[model samples]
Every structure is written in structure tokens, then in C-alpha cells.
Target chain A: MIAIERNLVTPRWQRVALPIVSLVMASIIAGIVLAVSGHDPIGTYQQIYAASFTADGALTATFIYATPLLFTGLGVAIAFRMHVWNIGGEGQLYMGAVGASGVGLLCGGWPLPILIVMMALGGALAGLAWALIPGLLRAYLRTNEILVSLMLNYVAGLFMYYLIYDSTSFWRDLTSSSALVFPQGKNLLPSSDWPGILLGSFTLPFGFVLGAVLAVLLLALFRFTRFGFEMRVMGDSPAAANYAGMRTRRTIVAVMALSGALAGLAGASQIGDFGHVLDPRGLEQAGYGYTGIVVAALAMYNPLAVVIVSILIGALTNAGFALQGPTFPIGLVGTMEGIILFSVLGGEFLGRYRIRFGRAPARAPGLDDEPGAEVAP
Target chain B: MNADLIVSIAVSAIAYGTPLVLAGLGELLAERSGVLNLGVEGMMLMGAVTAFFVSQTLGGPGLAVLVAAIIAAALAGAALALIHAFLSITVRVNQIVSGLALTIFAGTIGLSSYAGQVWGVGGQHGVHQLVKLDVLGLSDVPVVGPILLNQDAFVYFSWVLVALVTFYLFRTRFGLYLRAVGESPRSADAMGINVTRYRYVHTIIGGAFAGLGGAYFTLAIAPIWTDGLTAGDGWIAIALVIFAFWRPDLLVVGAYLFGALSSLGFTLQTHGVQLPSEFFSSLPYIMTVVVLAAASTTLARRRIGTPAALGVPYVREES
Candidate 1:
């Protein structure tokens, strides 16, 4: 019989080693899935790598996907860090786009810097409002935020369709005959487009820079702030927080709003940085909010790690779009992301416990046999 | 609406509600056994794709072909659930995350879409569809005749399955042990119940039920293939299980209620009840949110119906 023994302190080597093992394990699983579908796994991987990292315009394309992911990842990271499951990142992001696009359209003739700032705020506020529905309900009414937030994604998705496809909302472009024929959102003026930071050949999207800045602020917030201390303590042990008389409900609403704002940035970025028009199909298909969950999980909810992981996951998504075909289907991207998450969860489990092979020790060992054991001091 | 129109709407409501019943019943069993499998959507999609593929390729008599398709779909869903069972039960991954991962892995834009493409079934018309039945040949009778007597075989099967689950949960000795395991695994384990086995079996079976629900979508509803043909029925079904108070008898009622809501948009639009199609399309989801909030408030006060150990992994040594 095999028995799992708990690890008191995770050995330093295992932290680095387990991730590598998980990657290798995930690759094998992904390869098997690809092979079973009659696709060349090695070729697919190499193609994805080349398209995402090495092709001439590939890095730029990757940043296009990565921009929204960064915001959504940070949004999800904040809520998840505080043990608040805000899976409504997708909906929040859509609302964010609606929010930002509305602002850009309203004041497209404004000065460039001011227009960008207003749009960002508009997006963030929209996303925050959307997320607060679940957040407030969770805090006050004790509803399951998971179900509420997740369900709202569909509602938000439908709302976007309504604005563009069904209703003659302000967002819908009904002016020119061509615009009416296509049934699209009014395009933002050229001045509303946010400028990117250029580094020689590749340009860093303005949103990515904002997300990176937020990451530092987030890191500092946790490392230095009293609020962060309370948040972390509350996340780690709610009972302890209750004993300390912390306002649990307030934190839930605040963090939920904050997380939603972050996702809203993603939507704002989509309008300000790239689309300039609210393209529901484009925004919906990318699924940045959902992928952000994967990024946050892979980064272990660390803001700094979220930055690097977003790029990595972004590259994978970029590769998926590049390699879309009858054989290399779009579904493979989500499938691979799921496998990566599964292996990570499994790897974390493996890291925590030592599995002993062969017959069990016939005797129930006393607590003293272990060093610095889990028992209270 | 006229009597004829009302009767047709009720018939469509039953048709739409059948899948919800199947998926809700499956989730009820899993949640009852202390395992909340949120991968119902993913499982349902996998079941749908696989069932569609089999129905197209099997090349047999209609009855045999449908049976094969359904079995394949159940196995596909169960196969996916085994992953969640192992992750949540043995590996001790967070149940919520595990279920979400399962959905992501097999969702519309995931393995199901990949499989549909690989099997050459995407955008193809179904070769065979599940036929509607007229029970007792009562076709000419009014109102109840069409509503009760007319439905696809799967709709009737869903009712039977609900009754079976109700009996299994309330009337049997094993049923008592199952609830005990869900309520307090430590106590159940102390009393010599194999908690692990019970969770694994029920979760897998629950996945099979979700599979059958997905099969209903491709086999009857549209008889055409598309990514996410079930739309958000799987998610709505999850809410159905919750608002039903985890009771199988109540689940049927809730399923039909949502079914009516789901069909409302389509029915109304056909009868010149002008509204945004999206509003009609979104009713079930909006209703789910409203009902779930209501359920949460009521359940919070009473703290009844929900299993004590739901979403918690049972590790014997830790206990």
C-alpha cells in the first residue's frame, strides 16, 4: 500500500523541481491528446513556438492577446489572493469595454492624454459596478458569488450582442448606410487611441505597462500596507479575522470592486489599445477573463509572476490563433490550458506530501517520530 | 395566446426542460454525496459531441443507433468526471477549481470542439434524430393530451430516472448510508462506510446523467451540430439543483419551470410578442441568478438540505 506523508516545510529544491516535473508531465499529456487526434504533437509545439516567439510579427501579435490577459489576470489574482472567488472576470471585462468605449465615443475629440485617462476610468468603473452585484450580494446576503458571477457572464455576453446585433443602443452604429448594413459599434476617433511604449522592434502595449505598474503597487500593497496585512490574515484564517473583529463584509465588497476594476482595464485596453470599436465577437472569442484565471492560478496568485505567466499563456493563445485549421482546432488551446492547470494542482499536491511505496508500517507511529510536526506548539 | 399556441408552448417547454431535468438530477446526486461537480457543462458538451458522432457514423437501425449514441455520450461524460473524482477525492485539489478545470478542458472551445472537428461532425446535419412519442395514442385529446402524452422518449425517461433517484436517496438502506457519508464522512467512515467508493461511484454516475442531457440536445432539440449547442442549459441546470433544495421531486418541477422560461423567448417571438431576442434568450440565466439569491437567503437561515461535507475532500487520516 502507498501512503502519503505530509511535508512540514516544503524543501527549497522541490519548489523549483515540482514546477519542472509538472511541465514535463503536462507536455506528455498534451502530446498524447494531440497524437490521439492524429496531429503531429512535436510539429504542433514547434509551430506554436515559432509563431508566438520567433516569427517576424509574432511578438507583436502575442502582445495583442497578452494586453487584455494582463488586466484580467491581475483582476482575478487580487480576488483569488483574498480567497474571494470572482469568476466574473469575463463579464466585468465586457462591461469594461462597454464602459470605456462609451467614454471614448463621447469625448473622442478631447486631448489624447485626457481621453485615454477618462476611458480607463470609464472601463474600470463599469467593470467594478458589474462585479459589485455579486460582491455585495455575497457580503450582505451571503449568496454564492461563484454562481452569481459566473451566470452574469452569460448575461453580459447577451447584453453585448444586444448592443451590436439586436437593439439600436447608443453603442450601435446606425449612421452611414454601410455602418447600418454591418450593425457595428461606432468607431472611436483616432485621438482616443493610447500610444504604446516602443523598445526597438517590439512595442509594449500601454495596457501591459499599466498592468506591470499595478503589479508593483500590488506587491508593495501586500508587503507594506496594514490593509494588506488584514486582508492576508483574513484570507488565511477567517475565524482569526472574526476574533480580531475585522470588518469581513467591507473587505469582500472592496476587493470584489477592485478585482472588477482590474478586469475593466482589460476591456478599456481592448478599446483604447486595439479594437477602437466594441467588437463583441472579437472580445467574446478571446475569452481573456477566463484565461486570466488560468494565468493567476499558474502564477500562484503572485502579481509579479502573473506578468510573466500572462506573456507565456498569451504566446500559447497567439499560437492557437496562428495555427487555427481543420486539424489544429481552436479547442486545443483551452484543452491545453486545462491540462496545464490540472498538472499544476496535481504538482502542488505532490509537493506537499511524500508518497511511500510498498507495505504500510505495521504500527501507527507516534507524533514524536516526526520533526517540527503539524501539531500545535 | 390561443389554446393551440399554449399547448404547443407547453410541448416545447417539456422538450426544452428534459435536458435540464437530466443534468439537474445528475448534479443532485453528486452534491448529495458531498461532491459538487461544476463540470456539468463540460461533461454535457463532451457527451453531446460524442453522441452526435456515434449517431452519424454507426450506420444502424434508428433505435440501435440512438442507443449506441447515448451510451457513448454517457461514457464520455463519465470519463471526464473520473478526472474530477480523482482530483477532488484522492489528490485533494480544490473541488471548485477542479470542476472549473474540467469545464475548461472539455468546454465548447476546448476538447469537445476539437473532437467535433476531428470526428468530422462540425456543421453537419444529424443523420438520425430522437423521435417524439405519443403515449397511449391520445393525439386528438386537448391540452393535457399533447402536454402529457406527447414528448420524446428521453423526456419520459428523465421522469423515471428522477423517481429512481428519489427512491435511491430516501427509501434504501444504502441511500441512508450515502446521505450520512455526505453529511459527515468521519462519522460514516467510523461506521464502516467506504466514503471514497461512494463519492467516486456517485460522481461518475452523475457525469453519466449530464451526458444523457447533452445527448438530448443534439439528438432531439436541434438535430444539427454546432459549438455549444446546449448554450447555457448546463449552467442553468446547476442552479436548478440548488433551488430544488437537492430534492429529486422538486428538481422536476424546477426543471420544467426553467424550461418554460427558456422556451418563453422563442414562443413569444413566434406569436408577435415583440421584444429583444437577446432578452428572451437571457431569461433563464437571469432567472437563475434571482432564484439562486432567493435560495441562498432562505437556505442560510435554515441551513437545511445542503450536505455538511459538500465540496470538502475526505481524507481519513486527516479526519
Candidate 2:
């Protein structure tokens, strides 16, 4: 039998080697899938690479998908670090979109800088409120947050449908006959549109800049704060945290709120940076919230790694979008994301244990007969 | 407001709820063996898409084709679950993440959709739809007959499965070993139960059940193929297992209860009830959260039924 025993200290070489190996393995598996399904794996991959990077405006388009993913990835990474399992990022993002769009609509006459700040805050606060439901339940009532948070996502998605298709709410475009018939969200004024920094060829979004800053802030928060210390203790062992008189309950709520706020910021970015309107179908189709979890997992729940991972995943998503047709299927991105996660998740074992191949060790000395020893006829 | 409306809803409830019963029972078996597979949705989709494809391509007698399709679906789901089993059990990875990976790999946007596109199964009507059984002419009887007796063979099989599983779980020694493995794997191992074997077998069996559930979508309920056609029913099925407290007998109750909530939107609308369609659509999801919260609260008080070793990878040797 094979045995795995936990190592007191993980080897540094193993830590660095595992992720690279995992990615290579995932690519090979995806290649096999392409080959089996009547496609040239190498050619298809080269095409994806070209669409995502080499083609003109591809990098700029990648940034569009990357911006929200960066925000949501950080959001998910923070929550996962605490083992909170806040899978409600999808719902929280929708609520954030609602909050940000509401703010943007009402504050259209305000200056761009002020309007953007209010919209971001509004989105963050709304997401926090939405996340607090499962957060409070998990902390106080001991409800399973995974299912609760996931259920809320369905509810939130339906709510978005209600806002756009069913009701003539403020967000609905009632003024335009074409929009009224189609039932789309009202557009924000051009003043509310976020500006981007023009690079030599690629344009960098304001939201992506904000996410980078947030990543640094989050790193600092974890590394240099008493709250972070308490949170770490609580996450590792809640019972120990309780015994130590740390506010584990408050930390639970705070972490969830922070996570939800990050997802909300993604929603705010969706509105301010790209969509400029509450496009329900478009937002739902993007599924950036779910993809964010993939980013967070691939990054090993580290906020800084999340920045780089988000761009890489964002490029894949853009390639999927750009190449969607008879030749390229839309499902490839999700399948690759899943495969990547599976590889990384399995590779997590390298850091945790050392496997020994041998016969089972001789049993430790015992009574030799267990209690309730078998009595047979 | 009449017997006809009530009867119609009741019939549809059982019809719609059959998939959940199939899937939830599978999840219950897995959870009872200490494997919390969150990939039921993905497994179900694989089953659904594979079953549809087989039913379309395979040439045989109608019944034989469907049976073959069902088997193919089960194998597809089990194939995915094997990955999950190997990862969570052997690799000692986090089960939650492992299951989510399976979902992402085989889910609506993943392999299932890819397979659907590759097979070109979309926009084609199911030629081999599940026919409702007359059930010894008892289907012609009063309201109970239509509600209970008029269900197809798939629904009846689910009932038999529920009964068989209930007996196997409670009465059989093997079931006892399975429960022991989940409750306390260390103790079970000490008791000479093969914890690894039981967990692997049961988790894969659970995936098979999820496959049957997904097959129901194409063969029986909707009679069509579409990406994410199961919607969020698999998630609801996962929640139903909690509502059942991991008992097979109670799983049927929870499934049909949610089934009624699922059919409510369409049933009531058909009966001319005026309400926002989305509100009706969200009922099952909302109710799942409510019931799960309630179940969790009750569980916290009772402190029973949950397998102690759930989501924890068992290692015989110490660090």
C-alpha cells in the first residue's frame, strides 16, 4: 500500500515546480480533448494564442474581460483564504451592478471622478449587504454557507431578469422605443464612462489599475494588521480563535463583507468600464464571477497571483469569445478552466505530504483484539 | 382551484421530481460514505447529453435504444466521478474544490456543451421519448391514480431504488460498514472495513445515479437537448440530501416537495394565475435555501445524521 505522511516542512523546490507542472499537464489533457473531437490541437491552440495576443486589438480586448475578473478573483481569493466558501460571488456581483447602475443613473449630472467613487461604493455596499445574508447565517446559525450562497446566486440572477425584462424600473430603458420593445437597461451618460490609459498599443482600464492597488492593499492587510492575524488564527482553527477570545464571528462577517465588496467592485467595473449599462443577458453570459473562482484557485488564493492569473484566464475567455463559430466552440474555456483547477488542486498534495511506496507498516502494539470482536456461528 | 388543476400539478410534480429523486439518492449514498460530491450538476449534464446522443445515434428497438442510452449516460457520469474520487480520496485534495472542478469540467459550459456541439444534437427533437405507463389500468382511476400511478417507468424505478437503498442502508451489514466508514473512517478502518474501497465504490455509484437523473431531462421531462437544460435542479438535489438528513426514505419527500415548487411556475401559469414568471421560477431555489437553513438549525440542535468524516481525506498513518 502507498502511504502519505505530512511533512513538518514543505520543500521550496516542490512548491515552485508543482504549479508549472500542473499547467503543462492541463494543456496536454485539453490537447487530447481537441484531438479526440476532430480538431488539430496544436493548430487550434495557436489560433487561440493569436486571437488572445498577436492579433491587433486582442490585448486591449483581453483587458476588457480581465478587469472584472481581476476584481472578482481578488474577492474570491480573500474569502477562500479564510475557508469561508462564499460561492455567492455571482449574486453579489449582480447586486453590485444594481447598486452601481443606480448610483450612476441618479448621479449623472455629477462630475466623473465623484460619480465613479459613489458608484463603486454603492456597488461594494450592495454586494456586502447581499453577502451578509449567508455570512451572518454561517457565523450565528451555523448554516452551510456554500449552498446558501449558491442559492442566492440563482435568486440574484432572476432578480436581474425582473429588473430588465419584467418591470419598468428606473434602470429599464423606457425612453427609446427600440429599447422599450427589447427591454434593455438604461444607458449611463458618457460622463459616467470611465477613462482608460492609452498604452503604446493596448489600452489599460482604470478598473484594472484599481484592482492592482487593491491587491497590494490586500497583501498589506494580511501581512501587517492585527485583524489579519486574528483572521488567520480563526481560519486555521475556529475553536482555538474562540478560546483565544478573538472575535471569530465578527471576522467571519467582515471577511464575507470584504469578499462581497470585491465582487461588487467587479460589477461596478462592468458598468463603469465596459457595459455602461445593466446588460443582464450579457452579464450573465460572461459568468465572470464563476470564472473568478477559477482564477483564485489557480493563484492558490494569493491576491497578488490573482492579478496575473486573471489576465491569463481573461485572454482565454477573450479567445473563446473571439473564436466562437463552427470551428471554435464556446465550451472550451470552461473545460480548460476546470482541467486547470483539477491539476492545481491535485498538485496541492506536493506541498503537504511525502508519499512512500511500501508494504503497510506493521500495526502498532494494541490489545491485538478490538472491542466488539466478531462473534460468528 | 379544481381537482383537474390540483391533479395536473401533482402529476407534473412527480414527473419533474423524478430526476431529483434519482440524483439525491445518489448524493445520499456518496455523502453517507463520506464523499461530498458537489459535481452532481456536472454529472447530471453529462448523463443528459450522453443519453440524448445515444438515443439519437443508436439503431435498435425503441426500448432497447433507451436502455442503452441510459447505460451510456451512467457511464459518462461515473467516468467524471472517477476523476473526483481519485483526486479527493487518493490525492487527498479538498473534496469541495475537487467536486467544483468536476462541475466546471463537465457542467453546462464544459464537456457536456462541447459534446452537444460536437454531436450536433441541438435543435433535434427526441425520437425516443419516455412513454407513461398505464400501470395495470389503475392509471384510469381517481386523482391518486394520475398523480401516483401514471408516472413512467423511470419514476417507478426511482421509487424502487429509494426502497432498495433504504433497506440496504439500514438492514444490510455492508450498509453498516459504509455508514461506519463515513462516520469515523479511523474507527471503521480499525474495524477492518476497507474505507478507501467503500468510498470509491459509493461515490462512483452516486455518480451513476446522477447520470440517470440527467437522462430523465431529455428522455422524459423536456424531451429536448440544450446546454444547461437541467437548469439548477442538480443544486436543488444536493440541498435535498441535506433536507433528507442523509436518509434515502426522506429523500423522496424532499425531492417531490421541491419538485412541486419547480412545477409551480408553469403549472400555475397554465392555470391562468397572474404572477411574474421570474418570481415563480425562483421559488425552488429560494425554498432550497430556506429549507437548508432550517435543516442546518435543526441539525445544530439535534447533532445527528451528519457523517463525521465528511469532506475530510482519511490517512491511516499519522504525521
Candidate 3:
């Protein structure tokens, strides 16, 4: 049998350097494309980097953009480690926003701290409920969770559209023309806002810290907890998990719920920190939910890796906006993020196999004549 | 509550179902041949935007839809499927990831959005919409006729295409070969079938149909060149493929069913129904989940057929 040995050795530095190399390659290719189109590649890139980091208000925007991604990335990473494809992060996030908004509306006159906690709780539960559909299906009936979760994202979008656009409702504010002009939910009160932390020269939001803490806790749980081990086992092989007498169904459901909850937290956090109300159109390509997938992939499903990668993506996204001047539209700048992700994924090939030039031999029918075939000595 | 309400609802459903059927039939072909494409949504969006732009430029809805269907929509969709085929078939990347990446790359907010902005202003209203195709004598018949025969040419074409696809899948040798490849690529490969070729060709062709569906949306339904026109219809098409049980014929039923559900929300809103419009708007997605759950039940899973290795990348192992 061709066994994948469970070696404890750390991945080599060359493996780590592959993505960087691929990024350089992708940039060079992108430069060629830009040159063909008569745009100055280096000038555009320089502006992008400057805008993402050094410029005033640039860093804050990046953090604001990264806020939702941090939560959703953790959400995706949590489920990914368990080999569960929870593509419903978008839906979960929307549900969380809906839930948080509900709490904010209902709990009038409550203490700020209690209201904030309740808002967060409501969001988490909503996300959990959104994810629960696929979780239950997979646990009980072995339905394809991927499609179900994905469809839910659209469902969530439509649900949000209705929540915001319905005129005669508590969610809608008839108080002004701006609200009338824009079909969206009522804005959050000032009290529900999340306070930011200033780090001398650079100021970062609490969402970043929340994201980091969650990543650390997740990493520790995976490294030290029995629950983590069971998840790892299940990811490797459901048969092995069954053999070990694990409560596979319950574990899958719980893991999915946890994943959904994290995504929900992201949605709720965004609503609390950035906007007062829900705008379905504004959230359509929030990009953070899908961006989280890239982060999780880059991290190789490692929680710590998720944090580092999330920051990188956040920086790139900020740069995309920064590069958006009159000459170069921001949309093309956004294309750079896509380039980075594609390059990283393409680079992943380096970790698994070596490419050889020789043609593969055609093995005859009666070759090993065994169920478990072996590599020739 | 009345007959008129029922007729209006039926009309809206048929209008909505037209695009769904086209996309679903295309998806059925791709899945039958062993590749599950997740880029259908992006392709449709490209088609819709392109058709809207072309119609405005050409000053004729017919010519614009034709160009969009063949060049912009089909070509765009096929281009994405090409990437998917290369990754899943040739280079052997993960099907789900490659497909998802393709969606994000050519996303609603991606290339099409930019294209829509560049096309600018003189939008879909400038183009002539396709005249409804009436089957003369059939038009006078009550409920069924209004919803079926008395409609746009695309609507009739969608059902006809579904029938044609159903026949091709079940009654042809190539169809048998396609099914074999999906069920067991290795076995099919051993039997001298070009596994990669079958997957690439069918996947691309499937994309063409999806693109056509998108063009239909821009030229027929919305009839306007708006950004994000297809919305999430492409993804809905993917879901419909599953709901239809990979059968081309059943796609007609599933498409109409979803189309009806989706339009029912908007129709209810127009009638001043007290129900929250969001509940109606989100019907398609909710129905998808419910249907999927129902289909996944032990009793249903066995009965509902799935293409074996539907999402697996075919890698030719070196001996």
C-alpha cells in the first residue's frame, strides 16, 4: 500500500517560501499583461502599497475591511479543519447581522453592556441556526452539505433585502429622505458601537484582537484537546473515526455550529462597528467571507496561520482601494488580490509532489494482483 | 385569491422559469459527464451584462442577445469551464476550489461590474425586447395556454431544449460513454474512452447553455442593462440540477417550480400583500434548502440519482 506516513517533521523553509516565489511570478505575469495594455505596472503597484499602509485613513479602512473577514476566516478555518465544507459563511454572517439588529431593536433601555452581550448572543445564535440546516442534513441524511450551505447564502441575501426594503416596519425608518432614498434597515444607535484600541502611531479595532484571541484559542484546542483530536481523526477518515467509537454525527453538527457562530460574530461585529443599518447591496460581495476561504487555505487550516493570512489579505485589499485614483480604477486594483490567491493556490503544488519528465509506465493487468498495491523496490 | 391572481402568478413563474430551464439542462449535461461546475453563476452574469450592452450598442434586442449568447455569454462561460477543465481534468486541482475561485474572479462584483460601468448609460430600454411567440390556436386556451403557449420564444425554446437534452442523455452512445465516465472514470479510461476530452467538451458546452440563460435574462426578462442583473440565478441553476436529480427532463419541472416560487414573492408585493416581502423574495433559497433536505432523507437519497465522483478530480496516477 502507498502509505502517507504520519511524520512529525515540520515543513521545510522552501515549502514556506513557495508562496512568496509564486507571488513574484504572478506579479511579473501581471506586469506583462499591464504592459501589453499600456499601463505602467510598477507605478500602479507602488501607489497600491503606499495607499494600503503609509497614507492617512488608509490603515483604518483596511482594518474596517478586515474586520468581517477576521471572524469569517476563523469560521471557515474551524470547519475546514474538520473537513466540513461550510460555504454558508455568508449566510451565517447575514443571520448574525439580522440577529444582532433584532436584539438592538428589542432590548430598549437595557444596560449598554448587557445589550451588547445580548446583541452578540443573538447574532451567534442566528448564525448557528443558519448553519444548522446543512449540519443536520449531513449528520442525518448524508446530503451534500456544500450545495445546501451555498444556497443559504443567497437565501440570506434575499432575507436581508426584505428586512431592509419593507417600508412599514420597525426595521425601516421613515424619519428621513436618506433612509427613503436607500432601501435598508434602520441604523444602530451610538451605544451599540465597538470601541477601538489606539496603538501609538496606528489605531486598530477590537475586532482584530477578538479575531487573534479566537485564533489562539482554536490553535490551542486543536493542539491539546481531545475534541480537536477527534475532529482531526474524522477529517482524515470517517471509517477510522467510527472504528474509534467517536460520536461522529454530534461532533460534525457541533463543529459546523461553531463555524457558523464565528461567521455570525463577524456580521454582528461589522454592523456594530461600521454601519447603523443593514444594506443587502452593500454586503453582496463583502468579499470577506470568500476572502476567509483563501486565508484558511493559506493557513493550511492552522488557526494561527489564519490570523497571519487574514492580515495579509486585509493589507492587500486596503492597497487595492489605495491604488484607486482617476487613472487606474479600483476594480482593476482589486484584481491583484485575485492574483495573489491564485498564485498561492498554484504554489501549493510544491508541498505535495515533485514533477518528473519521464513518461509514466503502463502497468499490465496482473501487476501486483493484490488489493493493496506497493511501490516497486 | 382570484383567477386573475392565479394567472398573474403563473405568468411570472413561466417568465422566471425560462432562464432556469436552459441553465439546468446545461448543468445536467456537465454533471452527467462527471464534472460539477460551480462557475455557472458568474458565466450567467457575464452573459446578462454583455447582452444588455450589446443590445444597446446594436439597437436591436435580437442581434444583441444573439451576440451575447454566442460571444459574450457562451464564450465567457466556456472560458471559465476551460479553466475548470484544465484544473480538474489536466492539472488535477480540487474541483470545488477551482470552481469557487473562478466564481470569485469573474464574480458579480468582478469583471462584469467593470464591464457594465464601461458600457455606460444607454442601457437595456434602448434595445427591442423579443416579441412573444404565440401558437395561434393554442393562445385562446385558458390557464395552461397563457402560462405555456402564449409566451416569449425563449420560453418555448427552454422546454424544447430540455426535451432534446433528455433524449441526448438517455438515447445516445455518447451519452452512455458520458455516464460511464461520471460513474467510474478509471474504468472508462481503461476502456479507451478519452476521459479528459469528454469532461472538457461537455463542461464547456454546459457553460454555453448557462451563458444563453444569462442572455435570456438580459434580453427577455429584465430587458435592462443593470449591474448584477443575474444576481444569484447561476447558483440557483446549480441547485436546480440537483433538485432535478440530474435528469434533463425533470429540469423543466424543477425550473418552473423554482421560477414560480421566486416570482411569487415579487407578485405578492405588487398585490399589496401584508406579508413581509423579504419572506417572498427569499423563497427560492429557502425552498432550495428544504428540497435538498427532503431529497437527502435516507429514502430520497437512494431514489435520487447522483453522478458518482461528481466532484472528484481525475488524476492519472503514474505507474
Each candidate's chain A: what TM-score?
Answer: 0.92, 0.92, 0.86
Model 1 per-residue lDDT tens digits across residues B1-319? 5898888778888888998999999998888889999899999999999999999999879999999999999999999999999998888777887888898899878889888989989878998898878888995689988898877788888888988999999999899999998999989999999999999999999999999999999999988778877887888888888788889988898888888888898888888899998898888888888988898887656866888889888866542
What is the C-alpha lDDT profile of model 2 across B118-237, one tens digit per residue? 999988899998899999889989998898888888899989999999999999999999999999998999999999999999999999999999999999987789988888888889
Across residues A98-134, which tens digit of lDDT does each residue of candidate 2 receive? 9999999999979888998999998999999999999
Which clashing pairs does model 3 show? A187-A276, A188-A276
User: Candidate 2 — which residues are off by over 4 angstroms?
Assistant: A1-5, A12-14, A355-377
> What tens-digit string does per-residue lDDT give for candidate 3 at A1-377?
23332112336774567656766876886676556556788987777666776787777877877778788888988897777889899889988988888888777557877877887788889999999989988898877788889888878887777666754567767677787676657777777776678877666877688778988998888889999999988886778899999999999999999999998888777777677576667677565677777667656677877777777677766776555444454445334544555565566644444544456445587652332112100
The two-chain DockQ for each candidate, comma-separated, is 0.59, 0.50, 0.38
Better of 1 and 2 by DockQ: 1
* Winner by TM-score between candidate 3 and candidate 2: 2
Candidate 3 TM-score, true structure as reference: 0.88
lDDT digits (tens) for residues A188-232 of candidate 1: 988788998887788889989998999989888878998788789
The prediction achieving the highest lDDT against the true structure is: 2
For residue A223, what is the lDDT in candidate 3? 80
| Candidate rank order under DockQ | 1, 2, 3
- Candidate 3 stretches with Cα past 4 Å from truth are A1-10, A25-40, A101-119, A167-192, A276-281, A285-287, A319-339, A356-377, B1-6, B58-71, B121-128, B136-145, B269-272
